[model samples]
Structures are given as C-alpha cells and as structure tokens.
Target: MTKNNAKAYWKENLRYLFILLSIWFIVSFGAGILLKDTLNHISIGGFKLGFWFAQQGAIYVFVILIFVYVRLMNKLDKKYGFDN
Candidate 1:
C-alpha cells in the first residue's frame, strides 16, 4: 500500500480500538461501579443491571468484545489488503 493509505489504515484501526475499549470500560467499570445505584433502579429477570454487570455481564461482554474485535480486524485487514 502507499504511505498515505497505510497511515489511513492505522488511523482507522486505532479509532476502532479506542471506541471498543471505551465501551468495555463503560460496561465493566462505569456501569458496574460508578453508576451501580442508578442502574439498580431497573431490573432484568430479577437481577439489577448494575449487579449483573459487576457479577457476570462484564465478563460476557468482554468475551463478545474479543470476538467482535477479531471479526472487525479480519474485515479491516482484508479491506486494506493486509490479510494473507
């Protein structure tokens, strides 16, 4: 790839990484700790959102995020002609 195109690809990858990490932090730490009480007002299947996040939801989200990142990165690599 040309220099400009390579720079653009790296920029896009960094942007996605930042966005995904931000969401992960929000779900794991923000919702689980900082906003726990506020979220507790609402419940799902007898479990409070905040409590669920702290106890189990964060782990699940992390797993899903890993898969999502892998899928997105694969697509990005292919699009940028970086895939083998």
Candidate 2:
C-alpha cells in the first residue's frame, strides 16, 4: 500500500480499537462498579444485575466484543486491500 493508504488504514484501525475499548470499559467498570447500586435493583436469572456484571456479565461482554472486533477487522482489512 502507498504511504497515505497505510496511514489511513492505521487511523481507521485505531478508531475502531478506541470505540470498542470504550464500550468494554463502560460495561465492565461503569455498570459493574460505578452504577452498581442502581443496577442492583434489577435482577437477571435471580442474580443482582450489578453483581452479575461484576462477576459474569463483563466477561460475556468482553467475549462478544472480541467477536465484534474480529468481524470489524476483517471488514477493515478488506477495505484497505490487506485481506490477502
């Protein structure tokens, strides 16, 4: 790829990474810790939502985000002609 194309590719990649990481942070830290009390009022499968997020929910979200990132990266690669 030309220098300009490479730069643009990396810029887009970094943007994706930033957005994904932000989501993870909000789900893990915000829901799990910062908003625990408000979330605790709700329940999922008999477990308090905040507790669940602290224990299991965050993990599930992280895994899902991993798949999302993979799919996004695949599309990005194709867009930048880096799929080969």
Candidate 3:
C-alpha cells in the first residue's frame, strides 16, 4: 500500500480501537462501579445488575467487542484493498 493509504488505514484502526476501548471502559467501570448503586436496584436472573456487570457482564461485553472489532477490521481491510 502507498504511504497515504497506510496512514489512513492506521488512523482508522486507531479510531476503532479508541471507540471500542471506550465502550468496554464504560461498561466495566462506569456501570460496574460509578453507577453500581443505581444499577443494583435492577436485577437480571436474580442477580443485581451492577454486581453482574462487575463480575460477568463486563467480561461478556469484552468478548462481544472482540468479535465486533474483528468484523470491523475485516470490512476495513476490504475497503483498503488489504483483505489478502
């Protein structure tokens, strides 16, 4: 790939990383800690929502984000003609 293409691809990859990481942080830290009390009022499968997020939800979200990132990168690679 040309220099410009490489720069653009790296830029987009960074953008994706930033956005995805921010989401994980929000779910793990925001919901799990900062808003724990409010979330605790709600329950999922008999477990407090905040507790669940702190223990399991955050993990699940991280895993899902992994797949999402992979799919996004695949599309990004195709867009830049780097899908080989």
Candidate 4:
C-alpha cells in the first residue's frame, strides 16, 4: 500500500502487458505478413501456414495470450500481496 510498492506493482503490471502484447503483435503481424513467404512453404490442414495465421492463427494466439495474461496477473497479484 506504500507509494513505492504501488509503483513497483504498476511497473511489473506494465511489463507483463508489454510482453504479452509483443507476443501478439509478432504472431499477428510477423507470421501473417512479414514472414508470410517463408511460412508459406509449410502447410497445416492443407492451408498455408501464413494464410492460416492471417485468418485464424492470430485469433487463436490472441485468445491464448489472454488466458496467459490472466494467469500471470493472478500470480503477480499474489506476489504483491494484493490477491484476495
């Protein structure tokens, strides 16, 4: 509850947020666009990996990231003695 603790908690929260978002951006943008050609050489369920990422992979990754974020934040809350 001290100012320093609050600041540290927020800083850690932001760090987690940044890391999660970066993973999302890399999956959505990198696989879907920047690395499309390279990934195109591979296929999943008869669909090109790159194409799948553009249409569906990104979404799956996003959902997974959400769950991961929630789990991580819960741990963080416990670490900071803020959990109920």
lDDT of 2 by residue, 1-84 (tens): 899999999999999999999999999999999999999999888999999999999999999999999999999999989999
Query: Which residue pairs clash within candidate 4?
Result: none
- In the range 1-84, model 3's lDDT, one tens digit per residue, is 899998999999999999999999999999999999999999988899999999989999999999999999999999999999
Candidate 4's TM-score reads 0.89
Most accurate candidate by TM-score: 2
lDDT of candidate 3?
0.96
- Residue 14's lDDT within candidate 2 is 97
Q: After superposition, how far is residue 29 of candidate 4 from its true place, in Å?
A: 1.0
**Taking the tens digit of each residue's C-alpha lDDT, what string does model 4 give over 1-84?**
688887999999999999999999899889999999999999988899999999999999999999999999999989888997
Instruction: List candidate 4 segments past 4 Å from native.
Output: none
Model 3 bad stretches (over 4 Å): none
lDDT of 4: 0.93
- Judged by lDDT, which candidate is best? 3
Sorted by lDDT, highest first, which candidate order results?
Answer: 3, 2, 1, 4
Better of 1 and 2 by lDDT: 2
- TM-scores of the candidates are 0.91, 0.92, 0.90, 0.89
Give Cα-based local distance difference scores for all models: 0.93, 0.95, 0.96, 0.93
Give candidate 1 regions above 4 Å deviation.
Answer: none
- Candidate with the larger TM-score of 3 and 4: 3
Q: List the residue pairs that clash in candidate 3.
A: none
